[model samples]
Target: MKNLDKLLEKYAKLCVKVGINIKEGQPLVINAPIEGLEFVRLLSKNAYELGASEVYVNWSDEVLTKLKYKNSPMEVFENYPKWKADSLEDFAKRGAGFISISSDDPELLKEMDPKKVAAANKSASIALKEYRKYTMNDINPWLVISIATRSWAKKVFPKLEEEKALKSLWDAIFKATRIDQEDPIKAWEDHMGNLKEKVDFLNNKKIKSLHYTSKNGTDLKVELPIDHIWAGGGSITSSGVPFAPNMPTEEVYTMPDKYGVDGVIYSTKPLNYGGNLIDEFKLYFEKGKVVDFSASVGEEVLKDLFAIDEGAKHLGEVALVPFDSPISNSNIIFMNTLFDENASCHFAFGKAYPTNIKGGEDMTDEELEAHHVNNSLTHVDFMVGDSTTSIVATTLDGKTLQIFKDGNWAF
Candidate 1:
């Protein structure tokens, strides 16, 4: 926790300069938890210093959100306010740079009715469908970063008191984002360069499919779309501006063919979904659909997730991360997808990113579906890789190759 303020100032600059890479004349919109007010102020100041046209912060407090769920009738969760959706559309149309400060309490809604949570989630996703396309398609810049809150920090460092846990969690976050280093931006450039190497390799190989096996009883294979692009480290806007989507990203990922997956996969870590944790889950797939599934925890929530839409039962993304990755070495479970998903190999259910496929940007939703890309209202990621995992690829040459050995990338 030494130099906490100094580290935070550096973090704010990094989020503006490197994370979202805000353009000079573009406005910035931030979605932040009230607990992160101090950091949000710093972030807005940095954006203004970089010549951002304006800064808007949308404050969210989970306590109020949970209160609504507790007191509102069932019908209340079934509909979302159209005015809020329209406001987001207005921002995206003006080419706003967006940042999300996520400090989630892993078990905040543990005792809430799963049905209510599911309904609210579905309604919001439906209403915001248009606004989501901008970030999903890389039409505008977007980034997700985190700060430590009492509940979230305690979840990560359970044995410590509130203040101690906050300090420890902040330390973990700084190290993960390299904000603890002398020059975080330069460190990120070096990290992205390494990720670019893997991207270039995968693109050059023209891989057909990947076969995976692990000690946790995972034996699955997922095929790549004909023109799928492997992307990681950074992303570019439709107009050519570059930005990093996830501050501490370490995975190279692409969409998998919606109809070309088979076998089974097991979760290596708890999946924190809508404040509920689904742990020790096993999903069985056949020809790309999740035919059967089981979870030792939050089974009802898992069911509601799959019920979101037909595409929810199919694979949208396949990502690769080394077992010896920095986050993995830290031995801390942040219980947040942005952090945990980067710690190991993972897969997403529901919508596939439009930018993942060649010419996908201009293709209509129907066209994308015809090309075998899964589409849904939600995209949820869960970890599955460990040191015992191995992935074999069938290249364009029609032969088996080792893409991953012992959970790390293999030449």
Candidate 2:
């Protein structure tokens, strides 16, 4: 086995230096899954070494969530803990660096209620939207990464033994996140430079609309905001401090007009909601709003999510991940949206991106509405890539150009 201790130390240092850009005397907050305990602990130790004032680790366990699903009452799902809400606010006000880790056991929810799972996860956020708003606004720097647990490693490599699978997945994630470079920081700088090129090209082209079509789908016409900034690779908070968004990412994304999307789209991956798995879901949109949705499983979860608020039904993030992405080349269907979206192009529902739109967050509700900035606490992403799916940009000058062909970037 590779020296796990050394790996943890190296990973933590990278997170502090490159991911979160930990500053002296800065407070740090980690929302880590139990699977990531080792990395979290090492990160805390590193934070102290970096002169952090305090390091808070908020741990979550899928087993605990499973128990709640099996035992908690329906009403209990709606109410959130006041302390938890306060904690999010505290982190935001303190300008704490937020780091999140994802390492879920894929089969844990194989038999659970997808709707109930979705409800449980969304309940806390809906109850704490204000604090979430602060974090989303990049009140401070933030970083997110994934760890390989026994179960997650199993999901990634079903044929291998636990130890081997873990090593393999670890190698994959490390490489994908650019942790193996001789100078990883410089590697990120170069990668972000390439992403900036794509964004700059799109921004300069003044693309006014996006049109998409595939075999069973032929229905989305999206309007892009004038002066919108296409962001990808890494992002700085409103504070001008840089941080990594996705652990292994290759996408330039912008917010879509909440009221400007029209058509039907199919989900390319299974969704985990309310501790249950929802599969084969299809959504129909009308005038930038999700008017209807259906799934072979967990339809109720989607219904409840749509009922959250007007903004919940609107689109938030519109991202493009090329078909040749490393994760995509793995050719393994994780059945999880996060990994699946990283493999290919995807979009989200709810909570618009402030950086994507010009003056997005500062705009009044009226002003934002005019610009089609979607608003909601629930931002859910789903994959939509297919071999025939393509994207075309309609320039502001009324010229049409192909940007992607068969799930690949044309530029």
> Highest TM-score among the candidates is held by which one?
1
Residue-pair clash count for candidate 1? 0
lDDT of 2 at 123: 81
All candidates: TM-score: 0.99, 0.93
**Per-residue lDDT of model 1, residues 1-411, tens digit only:** 348989999999999999989878899999999999989999999999999999988898889988987999988989888988898889999999899988889998898888899998899889999999999999999999999899899888999999999999989899999998999999999999999999999998899999999998999989998999999999999999999999779999999999999999999999999889999999999999999999999999999999999999998899999989989999999999889998999999999999999999889999999889999999999999999899999988898889899988887
Window of ten residues with lowest summed lDDT in model 1: 1-10
Give the runs in model 2 whose Cα sits over 4 Å from its true position. 113-118, 216-218
Instruction: Give per-residue lDDT, candidate 2, residue 376.
Output: 84
TM for candidate 1 is 0.99
Task: Report the Cα lDDT for residue 101, model 2.
Answer: 80
lDDT for each of the candidates? 0.92, 0.78
